[model samples]
Target: MSYISGARKVRVMARYDVIVVGAGIIGAAVSYYSAKKGLKVALVDKKYPASGASGACNGGLSYFGKSGKLLQDAYDSLILYRELAKELDYPIEICQDELFVQLATTEEEIAELEKNVEECKRFGLDAEMVSKSTLHSLIPGLSNKPIGGAIAQGGLHGFVNPFTVIYGYLDKVKKLEGTIIPNWEVVGILTSGRKVKGVVNKKEEALYAPVVVISSGFETAYLLQSLNLTLNIMPNRGVVLVTEKAPWKLKKKLMGANFGSTGQNVSLCIEQTLEGNLLIGSSQEIGVLIREPNIDLIARIANNALSFYPSLGKVNIIRAFTGVRPHREEGPFLGEIKEYEGLFVASGHGGMGITLAPWTGRTVALMIAS
Candidate 1:
């Protein structure tokens, strides 16, 4: 394929071993890992890297809230993220401990935390039930209203700078001779019979490849539908509020035990970033496509933050942002599709996209290589 650049039309390779759609964390990680395995890879995105949910998320690498296969997958991904934080050129700000607080009014929630801790231990995770006194010792200024809590430590929880991880992966991909195409929208998937051929861009230019991986997050469903594939990936909008840098430090990330419970209308996750800013989030609203900030949700988040940490009541909220996560009923789609020989999907991680990127990439790369 060739495109005009300035006064000249530059010609580029039309075919590659793999064509990764979307340059967000998932796609970027896939490209990096695949290229490291000596594959000629092409990564294309409608916008620049981290322009999607990867850039908007709070970057909490939490494992305690999840269980069953999801928790196992998160644990596997955490191992890779821990390694990358040390191995990569960039800093991912991986924090190791996470706290789940149970508000005093909810004795039921405190009991749930104890049960959750036991469940986590059964799954071989290091979880401990923190008494109210212990919780106070851990976080001196914490709201005494919380009866007790649980701390999921021993590398079971952490966080990363989502942008840093995305850029870091993209940089490694480039260093490994992978091609990156930004501002290119994939309009269609080009297929031959039952096998995948490549993709067509918005300009109607075709980029051929033997293998194609779709990691386009919220757009995954629409793109797959174009190829006669019915993927039920829904968009769930989450809003997060960022506060100005503060002098105080949080001993650990705080998440309400009831947050994200089924039938619950609102949820809150409060964490202090490595840069000293507090990220108060997030509300899960289903079927919201627009990425605009919701004033009500933002206010709710701020109120929740203040309720948990009274000191933050006066903190200035500098900005508010929203990210639409791709929600699938069957969890994230990974590996090749039997209907299409060369086509694969790695998406639907929802808010956990960044946290699971490393495992997703490694798994996809191995699948493609095999």
Candidate 2:
């Protein structure tokens, strides 16, 4: 047990068994899972849930190309989504449609796609290879490009609504007697020696908790600095375009093999949202946290979308938006901070925030509880 810090004993606002700083998908999951474990959880965020990268990201769960723990965690999260579809109060809208297709326009990409197929088979996942002719027949709105790519079937390889995932998870958390504190940005962590007491909100309110979890994306660095700790995390900005309701049909959620290479790569990812609007994007710019959309990147996304689907040339672009992912070279970090007891972290998910949220949350919640 801990109290308000300093000589002046300020009245503490509240206390919890676990305090999660960030209302994004990861935090939502942690809160929900922790509450399920019968722990009193308080989820705090600067704004609404999924306000950052989680809201802006597409709901694709592509765990096939990942390595080691990243791949295993992602795949496990995919399986969990099926159960969540029935459990969450909100509608997650996990796709019951065809597979997720990655179109390869060049030989280099085709070779990579082949390797991806092999990876899928090695893991007991289903994958299919379609020739250019078959690909055109399979998906109608193509522009005679893309020789053929990999199609991931089964599991939760399709797509889900990003916003809904956050709401659904947090809704369940609330129903489980957990707290949801929005607009309460955690500015400082109140610690006693090497042990965490709780955290200080932006308004300087002390909220006590034995276990404190930090998953506040780019803001995590500032929180870590309060304890003289450091982590290799950076913000990667991605831009996406939303087009008017298309006249034609897009059978599958398609991504170009060219995109998603690393920190600063552009994607030829095109998918139709459940709202029937065509979503196309994106360009990744790292080392910058600007959430504003880039004009040059916007233009490139439009041109690339047109190159693949000529039918979209006349389609009106309704709007554009950007989300910044907290990227780390070694993938996402999820575990207790050994230096400080009762402290844990879940951040640096890169662009795979949506794909890895379930695993990150459940695993971190267990770490704190166990």
Candidate 3:
């Protein structure tokens, strides 16, 4: 019902009920859920889906790595994951064999573990205090340098490939007759007085839609500022290393605030792919150069992995990469943009985008519905 700007005769395309910007996990989820609710949705992105932080992230759903606020969100997100997997019937690698191991290298660290265990239990999570012997029994190759650590049970960790989530959701969106346009960079947001009417793409093509959702991760701030909207999102870069296929006997995934014996602030997590390659990652450097993989940093990650599980030392490092997490100024950025009517945002998930995507999708859909 709206006219396309910069056209010869002002051609008008059918007006869309909702328009989602950025094809990352957040945007895809919004489009998928909105379309499922029978809304005419259009998902547009400058690049292809999963080409941003979603593509570069490690597939860990660890509750231990999450802060207090994110821990609550993670718990809710796990329930949402179960429902999503059932509804989508996709091959989601969700498993319940996740264990958090605290290598207590010092007396203070042991007390910290106790406190974390108590905190977990208070949150209704099943946690257990374990000794050094118990830790070794569970993970035979674990470093025996600690007096004791805490273990949290029933922790659900999954490995949902970002690309799989993107394509799977796209299928659902298409099935609902939703449109997906790639290579359509949003040049400007069109407003009717004080309300949003549509957005102009890079090619000067104006696409009209009543509701516009911005899910551009860290790039959202720049896009919103163009429309005189304020948003604070910072990019935190994480380095991940993949090791060659090896004899895999590590059953439970391990998480520790201390990656190595040096007591550094890093998370050492291990996940073996179906193809036998082991994925290990840690380290968060914000506002760092993200053009190429940092070999020195990735090597530190590998060493940390090996220090915890010596069995991985012999494995060759095949590849290394970095992913940028879109962290909001503080907490999550969801709901409507107060500055512009009809403009909504769902970015700044930090590093838990995959875990929260489904829930955010449903939440945004409800907002658009209302």
Estimate, for each residue in 1-370, the C-alpha lDDT of model 1 and write its tens digit. Answer: 5744323333444889999999989999999999999999999999889998888888888777677888888889988887796666776667765553434337888788778777778789888877788877877667766877788776557678888888888888888899999988988777767888788775567788889999998898899888778678888888889999978877577888877564444565788888889988878877887888868778888887777778786679999998888877677889898899999999988777877889899999999999
lDDT for each residue of candidate 3 in 5-82, tens digit (9 for 90 to 100):
432223345579999999998999999999989999999899888888888877666565344766777777767776
Q: List the residue pairs that clash in candidate 3.
A: none
Clashing pairs in 2: none
Note the Cα lDDT for every prediction shown: 0.81, 0.82, 0.75
Error of 2 at 181 (Å): 0.7
TM-scores of the candidates are: 0.91, 0.94, 0.89
lDDT tens digits, residues 171-253, model 2? Answer: 89888999999988887887787788888865567888989999998677778887788788888888889999877667577
How far out, in Å, is residue 120 in model 3? 3.0
Regions of model 3 farther than 4 Å from truth: 1-14, 65-69, 100-113, 258-266
lDDT of 2 at 348: 88
Cα distance off (Å), candidate 1, residue 370: 1.1
Query: What lDDT does candidate 2 reach at residue 139?
Result: 75
Ranking by TM-score: 2, 1, 3
- Top of the candidates by lDDT: 2
